[model samples]
Target: MANLNLTQNGNFSSLAPIIPAAGDDNGRSTLIFLGTGCSSAVPNAMCLIQPSDPPCAVCSQSLFVPPEKNPNYRCNTSLLIDYCQSDANRSYILIDVGKTFREQVLRWFTLYKIPRVDSIVLTHEHADAVLGLDDIRAVQPFSPSNDIDPTPIYLTEFAMESLAVKFPYLVQKKLKEGQEVRRVAQLEWKIIEGNHEKSFVASGLKFVPLPVIHGEDYICLGFLFGEKCRVAYISDVSRFPASIEYVISKDGVGQVDLLILDTLYKTGSHNVHLCLPQTLEALKRIRPKQALLIGMTHQFDHHKDNEFLAEWSKREGIQVQLAHDGLRVPIDL
Candidate 1:
């Protein structure tokens, strides 16, 4: 029943009765935040090169401090779902390998000792989401000599089409009969139907897709996963269709233990991503036990805004806050 039974010095607090204690270890898993910034990334390069008068306070602080030390320093929006099997095995299912994916892997994955990526799910074909598909090779091979099976990547057909034009080799491997497989990433693209809310299995775990509007006519997917505990994730989006809203609501089809959604700015609306006002509204409507806002830009001052969100959480009776890179929340499956 707990949304977050967490770590990293209690950044995650339990909202609903603590998952009936540790005795019930049925579907245990850990949700790790690989990165939590928007496409440009926190401390935008332009902000660093072309300075503002006083300089953006948040961007200013992002420098000279590692993201581990400062939550303000973000790479890209990504989450790693580490599912522990009842048989003592574990699988790593990564969501959205963005442009900063390499940086995230070197930073958090190394620190967390994430051995390998078993599967990958792309939110969309945006550069920030799928450009790092090439870098998957560095983490895939268990041995340097032999060629392994291509890692399964689940994505929408539109995204797959985009990748076909952008990264053709990754989709259809151009290997000669005797050629080696050590150059690029070995990948198998699996299309996820975006027209309807369908449940797909990645690594022995079921994931229900929640489709929402990205820009105007384009649709991006959010996912609903978990057995013992339900979790909903919508990383990049502007608005949800009526069907999406109801599907995620408690009275609709199901409920969420943890809701991870997108928020790009502190106040105004964005053409592609959700702003704070709309994010809060969605939280109110979806009514998850707890929520974490992701895909933030420099306009968001982590410490300052988190303080405000803390108060908002208190008043609204929902434990929602800004999710930072390196955030690890242990959750029930």
Candidate 2:
């Protein structure tokens, strides 16, 4: 393990190269943070405040600093789960292909050299989460062996219907007698009932969808990936149900190894997203071994936020931190 260093600019000084452990190297998995911003993303064009009007220093600094220097200057929220088989073959499971999907995917390829995405699991059908569906064409022919086989996509029926309406070309593939075939994103849609009554398997991975309320009328899914690596990702949650609490906790004790939660604002509440106060209350209940806050807005300054969280964690004796783009956490499988 390398010493973790925080730089003055509020980003990790350096990311240690991921190396497979010696012996007992059957398989390994890693969680990659592709983006950690809210729907409008950090440094939102409309929210840019100048220096004189009680300005937002975070967003203001983002205007001048390069993205390589500030990891908090983020796109929309999304995650990449990278799994390496014993044979050294690599596969990826993506969560939420957002508006910045193409940029994030290209960054992943340039930074980590990942070549293919095995599957995509959508959290909901919100534009910020699903608008990137068309960009999958960049990685067409997902599998090396089968060019025609579409990449598997797992989501709720509601989301499936939404995609069918939004991207008809990708969802419904048809041919005409005299028409030439057009190349589009090939996708295999799998519908999972997200009532929290059942679990689904995708590419040998088991996922339990924990239904959460996303405002007044919409329902969102927070997934729990089962196996040696226990992770619960609830990025757009406003309410956490008791049923999900039972699934993630062991006898009222938190058993989730990692809890990736949504904390969209520094303060105050929103009808659809979790604010800091609400997130802290939920954190106290979940009691996860480690928690990473995501779905942030430009109001959050990485340095300032971590400084507050560091003191809070010291007083509370719980390990929690804010997530940033390009951050990666390795999981033993």
Candidate 3:
């Protein structure tokens, strides 16, 4: 049985889970913080720059901020996890490809000097997350000097179903002649038999898929990586389950190293994402060394919230940082 307990409101935690011992595999794991803002992104005014008869009020307000403060403020919410460098490696496993994925990818290319993009692992097929699929094609055959080739995308069954419905052309392999080039790997939740929690080995990384509640649907999956340095990314989840303990607890070791999660609400009740109190409740139980909040919207000010959360996280003995674009955290495997 797991040590963590799920409250009536659905939160769970225990000791700080230790990073599990790595297998004999020698490949390393690297995480690139692509974007950390919500769908609107930072400098929310960018969203209004689209050709419109009247600009969005939100964007107008966002533009009022001093240019000195945020010269190029934009949403930051996507992350690219590159495991091994190979054609089938799916070198780029993205968490969420928001509306800014194009901008983020271009910026990442300029900043990281990327050569090619392999695949993307989508969280949920929300507009902010899925709209960037077209942008990915722009870089594919991604070689600047020469065409690299097309890319593949890995998504859960629900996410795949949703995306196919939204962008049929993207996933439609049989739609038309010569349109079968788009590649997609449909993921089915493996029912854990015996000691194994539903897991799949991809790109030399162990992907432990955990169930999370997204409103009435239990279709969302938060992920746990590696044996020990687990990261639970529940961006659009409303509730956490005790079963998640199985993913965090690594071979009798303790909890995850970090929890990059959603705090979509400030104080009011939300049936989609965890509010602040609910997030804290989960933090106490997960007991991660650090907890960074992502998927933030224009309603919250980054600097103000960062200062407040920092103090709160200190009191709770957990380092807290607000995610931003181009934040890279490299884990020594």
TM-score of each: 0.91, 0.88, 0.72
Candidate 1's residue-wise lDDT over 113-188, tens digit each? 8999998988888888888888998897755543678889999888888999998767765667886665678888
Candidates in order have lDDT scores of 0.82, 0.78, 0.59
lDDT for 323 (candidate 2)? 86
Model 2 agreement with the true structure over 91-202: per-residue lDDT tens digits: 7889999999998887765686777788999999998899998888787764433357788999999999988899887786665677656777788999999966688877
- The model with the greater lDDT, 1 or 2, is 1
* Candidates 2 and 3 compared by lDDT, better number: 2
For model 3, what is the alpha-carbon lDDT of residue 94?
A: 66
What total of clashing residue pairs does each candidate reach? 2, 0, 19
Task: Estimate the Cα RMSD of every predicted model relative to the unseen true structure.
Answer: 3.0, 4.1, 9.0
Residue 316 Cα positional deviation in candidate 2, in Å, after optimal superposition? 1.7
| Model 2 lDDT, residue 199, Cα | 86
TM-score of 3: 0.72
Which rank order by lDDT, best down to worst?
A: 1, 2, 3
- Which 10-residue span in candidate 3 carries the lowest summed lDDT? 1-10
lDDT of 3 by residue, 1-333 (tens): 123221222122322233212222245455666766666665565456672466544345455863223413546467777665433343656666677777776666666666656556566678877787766666564343322434555566667667767776555434465543443322222122112265765445666666677686655667767554667666777886556654554322466777788776557658777777787777777777766677666556555666787677767777665655555454432
**Candidate 1, pairs of clashing residues:** 227-333, 228-333
